[model samples]
Target: MQTTGISYSETSVRGRSRPSSFRQRFKHSASWLKGVAVALTLGSLLSGCGVVNHMIYKTTGDVMQGFSRDHTIPYLMASGDLAMGCAMSEATAPLLMSFGRVTNEPDQLAVMLYLSAGGCAEEQGREHELAALAAMYERKGNAAEDAIIRQKRAYSLAAKRYLKGWQHHNTYYGEPGTGECPDFDDDMDEFIYFAGLLAGLQALNSEIQSTSSIGVPKNVGSVVARASSCLESDKWWGAPMALKATVWAMIPGAQPEGEDAFERLAMTDRMGDEAGVRLSHVFHAIAATNKGDEAMVKSVVRQHAESLKEQPANEDWAFVDAMATNMIIAISDRLWVENTGHRTPLGRLGTFWDDQKAEVETMDLDGLL
Candidate 1:
């Protein structure tokens, strides 16, 4: 007998069909710091750069250093937000490998995508910091050359990391030994597109932040092409499933032509769509984008904050929302910070910690469900 709900695996909806079994089927499918002694030894090594003996950790290591180490790792492991934290860390694994860290998690490939998304965030943050860095250099006129070099280095880092993220993502998980990703799962596609969106945003952010503007990175083009391919095939199902695709649709250069556009995309199923007022805010945030809708954005963000407070144990959804919320909040915060220099506590939290707070918050879900 056919299950009552609309099948998640189906590409398109005829009208109002029951939700799919795959939603629950795949739903079932569902990182460590060094020791203190190891910490002391590494700290001494990281203190200096010029010496060959200098202990250079990975790009992640360096960035992580600026935050509160004790709290960061634990925070990332929390529930509902675990996938995002894993994704963020996995993205930087390649760079971290250069520093001699090793990761062999069963879900390494999936984690890689999430981590890459996180890395994209890091790259943008660095770009935003560049304008400030350049101004500082100008004031210290004596070190103008040094400032230029630093900016170049920063740009290169963002570009390089972005490119690497693109490489791992392009395989479509088709790479041998990565796991069996025959075709693409709708849920999987949801996460993949999220990563791609983050990548595209990073590319745009780089251009916006740079002293000399460059055209969008090739990865942006690749991502857009892939997203178009997904839509043309009608590869996703339901509202939540469609949200990622809809988000991609909004990307500046995603598709040259499309019917319905925002209205159609907004109509798709959204997870937690029935969760009442809590979800209204979430949906509002998702829907408010690119419309110069500041009021909607703030409303959604505040609603999300309220939801998190009520359901401290909302590990599964919390983790999911963490990534979603962080992306919206991060971009929103950057714009406000860059243009107005005014920041809310959450925005400020992101700027100072590079999404660590969000990651740490997820850690609380570690053993929950």
Candidate 2:
């Protein structure tokens, strides 16, 4: 009775209700929705492949290398635990070398690997230099004719290792026409580039300290000057500035008009503070030491200590942070070995041993003997 007349909403064909046709259309729509969802899922995965690969490579390299520097080596070095540091370096050497060997094509990761390898070589050179210093100290009072010979030999070995380090770093950048210098889209490229420059600087320092006649290449300075401009706007402003300051201080009459090297060194502190990396302090201290400016050295060292106290933790770039700490500690180690026959005091590596004195005091061995 209620359906005596067909409702306007109902479709009829040949006196038959078309409810089945509606069902068929609904089914077709459901299939189309499913296909659309599958297509979207595939598209998302395809679009994310490059990003995923990049992340994987970056994370792997950082974690492996960072752990070696931050957790294993620096702590060992700081605590005067060289045995373990050497062991760790040896164990990791093969793995690090493998990265270089596997890559025939130049890439960002390749550059990082080379830089890390160069760092390893540089550290080895430093160990030799320390050994030579210790040898000199051993013959401090005795008239040992052979002491000079031994020290010279050690210095020569150190210089060779440093040269090797420089060569490894030069593989990525610095050479006029040889290096790949591949473009990268992240902070790592900057870090690697800066590291290369640092290697060149260290190589030059090693040669000078060893009294070697080997001259620094003219192109090294040119490359550093050109590359530093790129780092000025990033978190690494302090690094390039420090490099410039170092170059100015080292080269005879190289300082530009109205530009003071010491001031440039000081400016790095603020930039480093903002970026949470104080490696510039190391460069500052080294340059000051080379100039025999004890006052400036102490000031920078004190500032470094205070900065460490303020930020005791390294939340990012642990490797670099640890390297900075290691370098500062090494400075303290040198002072202590020459004066006190020990490494730095437990927690006073960066601070001046005596604030009233501009120069480090040597021990009076006459009374102790």
- Each prediction's Cα lDDT score? 0.45, 0.61
- Against the correct fold, how does model 1 do in TM-score? 0.43
Judge candidate 2 at residue 141 and give its lDDT.
Answer: 35
Which regions of candidate 2 fall more than 4 Å away from where they truly are? 1-183, 211-219, 351-369
Q: Encode model 2's per-residue lDDT on 1-369: one tens digit a residue.
A: 376654444576666756666778999999999999999999899779867876776666566555653444344434433344445544665665454433332333333333444445445555554554565667653333344444445445444544554565556454623334546455555666666666566656656555665555645654565556656634674878887787778677767899998888888876776666777888788889879887787677778778877865345554565677677777767666665555667877665445445668799999997
On lDDT, the leading prediction is 2
lDDT per residue as tens, model 1, 43-104: 77766543443333343444543231234433552454544565656555555434334222
Clashing pairs in 2: none
Candidate 1 lDDT score at position 81: 54
Query: Which ten-residue region of model 1 has the weakest summed lDDT?
Result: 269-278
TM-scores, one per candidate: 0.43, 0.61
